[model samples]
Target: MTIEVNNESGLEIDERAVLDIARYALARMRIHPLSELSVIAVDIPAMEQLHLQWMDLPGPTDVMSFPMDELRPPSRDDEEPPPGLLGDIVLCPQVARTQGAEAPTAHSMDTELQLLTVHGVLHLLGYDHEEPDERTEMFGLQKAIVDGWRTEQGLEGPSPAPTMT
Candidate 1:
């Protein structure tokens, strides 16, 4: 899969490393090659605006997903994509940094951003975390994917504990 990451955040980051995380996440989900996913890192203003417009909330969010296949499924033949555009995952590092104060520096931001990308891909696959049960299932899958990636990378941190609510 072609994972395209856009550094719209005005901060320097290792694109290759981020892409590696995305690749790892996608592989775990059994997403095949030629399926492209877009990730955009943004600043707080943009994130806040999008959160307000899309979710009717006033505060900024860590991520927002715009699924290209929001309602339609790819055709049978086309689904074997050598080139299928999944959708867009917009993320905010500033918001992530704000979230970081709640935990460790790098761990919180990176894990949350990675979590959002996986969540975005799941959203593309028609996964919704709105209701209670749905949130449990979706968050469980997200934590699993993130934890697995960390284990493979030999990253140090507590595996996010599963939350029932």
Candidate 2:
């Protein structure tokens, strides 16, 4: 799977770290290699505008997903995906920074952003948090994925991944 990340935000985020995070989650989840997702980092103002325009919200959000709907698996004879574009995930680094500082201590903004990318990708794969049970399931999976990354990197102590809203 190709996890293409575009850093539109001014913050200096580690691309390799983010990619590793995505790769780890994808590998863990066993997502098909033909699948792909994009992560776009944005500033506060741009996120605010997108949130307002797309979600009808006034405040900037930590992350927003514009999923491209469910994928129709290839036929028995088909060799690859019809289109690799899974959809786009827009993230606000400044908002994430503010939210992360106040959220879980082990959930750093970088870690949270990586988690958000996975969450967004899952949404693109037809996962939703409309129901409480679904929210729990998704959150559990996300936490485990992020925590796995932190653990593999030799980060000491518990790493509390971000929860879905």
Candidate 3:
């Protein structure tokens, strides 16, 4: 998969780590390797504008997903998976920092951002948590993917789990 990250939040972040997490999540979901994805980090104003415009919420949200092509992972029975544009995952670092502080998980802002990135990608992959069962399935898979990535990076394991929005 081709993951593109554009940081316009005015806050410095580990861009490579974000790309790595996106790649790992897509790979775990069995998304086609040739799929394209974009991760954009924006300032609070940008996020708030998007939130109000798209979601019609009052303030900036941590993350938002805009899917394109509505691509789904190829089934095991399928012979070849076709390449497609996955979608755009918009992230707000300022919001993420605030949410990270309040999160039950005692992780750094980077980890929180990583978690949100995974969550956004899952949304792109057709995962939703609006219902209890959906929440269980989506969050379970998210934690597994994050834990696996953290282990691979030799980082300390996660703290208390953060509630997914």
Name the candidate that leads on TM-score.
Answer: 3
lDDT of 2: 0.74
Residue range 107-142, candidate 2, lDDT tens digits:
567766777776776666666788999888877777
> What's the residue-level lDDT of 26 in candidate 3?
87
lDDT for position 135 in model 1 = 85
lDDT of 2 at 34: 69
Error of 3 at 120 (Å): 0.4
Question: How should the candidates be ordered by TM-score, best one leading?
Answer: 3, 2, 1
TM per model?
0.80, 0.83, 0.94
Candidate 2, position 30, lDDT: 58
Write the residue-wise lDDT of candidate 3 on 1-165 in tens digits.
899999999999888999999998888778889999999999999999999999889888999999997777666855466789999999998887888788765566777889999999989888899999999998898899998888888888663375456
Misplaced by over 4 Å in model 1 are 70-83, 104-108, 161-165
Which tens-of-lDDT digit does each residue in 1-165 have in candidate 1?
A: 778899899865556656777788666666666677888999888989999999999978877788774533344644643345678888787766556546533345665566566666677767787798988887888788877887888988745443112
Better of 2 and 3 by TM-score: 3
Q: Which residue pairs in candidate 3 have backbone atoms (N, alpha carbon, C) closer than 3 angstroms, thus clashing?
A: none
Model 3, residue 79: what's the lDDT? Answer: 49
Clash tally for model 1: 1
